[model samples]
Target: MEPESYYFLEHRQDLWTFIRRNPEWYRYLTRDTERINEIDQLAKQYFGKTIPQRLEKAQHNIQLVRMLIDMAGAFRD
Candidate 1:
């Protein structure tokens, strides 16, 4: 196989803009999703569920981070 090039002119700018605007997404991509696995392990060790009972069994932990992510995705679409 050969290397790919970013020479698709129509998509070049859109790709650059999307990448430049989403540094956090890049950060998250760099982060190990194993972090979720770690959280899972903790939940299993402490209790017997994948999530906290107080948070999940009760009201959802609706926080700013998730809300912002959803809102941004909505706007993008």
Candidate 2:
């Protein structure tokens, strides 16, 4: 394994898990060791780690909670 690949295993365990669970990325990372510098950005793109994605997820969770609370209120006597 390349020293750059080891960076994923040793420095970024989260990214290591992501790659392990994803065969496509695992192959890409291992094969294109030169692109290791871009791994952080690529992982962010693949994993939807951007701000908009996070905001959207938060909004969806809030909406689900609101709906659950409303449903519970409707069931009250």
Candidate 3:
């Protein structure tokens, strides 16, 4: 699934809340080690960033979640 597919738009708030509550889950959801590392770096960056900055990042991250979910669905096929 492409990141711009709108799946993330529909579930953005829920996914944002989930990530904020369970940041570690990002590692589990993203099967790619590279992505995991990237997220880890991003997580570290989140510490000093403002809420708006984090929300902007969240918009991008939620698309990754949508991609992971779509990939999981593909596995069931």
Candidate 4:
């Protein structure tokens, strides 16, 4: 696989593991409309595509980043 694809898959797996480990924060992180919109915009800029086509991917990345941020907080000493 290409380096980009390899890292993408690895990051996705890590996100899934983090989600499983912290189910309680999932709903809250997913429901944040403001952050979601910001992420959507960034995805559009990064991918150079319009909505609906890129909506799902954007949302997924948003959730992953949010979860990672929360996980960092929880793990920080």
Tell me the whole-model lDDT of each prediction, alpha carbons only: 0.45, 0.76, 0.58, 0.55
Better of 3 and 4 by TM-score: 3
- For model 2, state the Cα shift of residue 31 in Å: 8.2
RMSD of each: 16.8, 3.0, 19.4, 18.5
Residue range with the least summed lDDT across 10 consecutive positions in model 1: 1-10
Q: How close is candidate 3 to the true structure, as a TM-score?
A: 0.34
Q: Rank by lDDT, descending?
A: 2, 3, 4, 1
Candidate 3 lDDT over 44-77, as tens digits, reads: 5555355777798899899999999999999999
Q: Once model 1 is optimally superposed onto the true structure by TM-score, how far is the C-alpha of residue 11 displaced, in angstroms?
A: 8.7
lDDT of 4 at 50: 60
Better of 1 and 4 by TM-score: 4
Per-residue lDDT of model 4, residues 1-77, tens digit only: 34443354356654435445656434634565234334434445545566675787799899999999999999996
**What shift in Å separates residue 24 of candidate 4 from its native position after superposition?**
49
In what order do the candidates fall by TM-score, top score first? Answer: 2, 3, 4, 1
Best by lDDT: 2
How well is each residue in 1-77 modelled by candidate 1, as lDDT tens digits? 01122232124454334435644433432454333334334435445344556566544446666788999999999
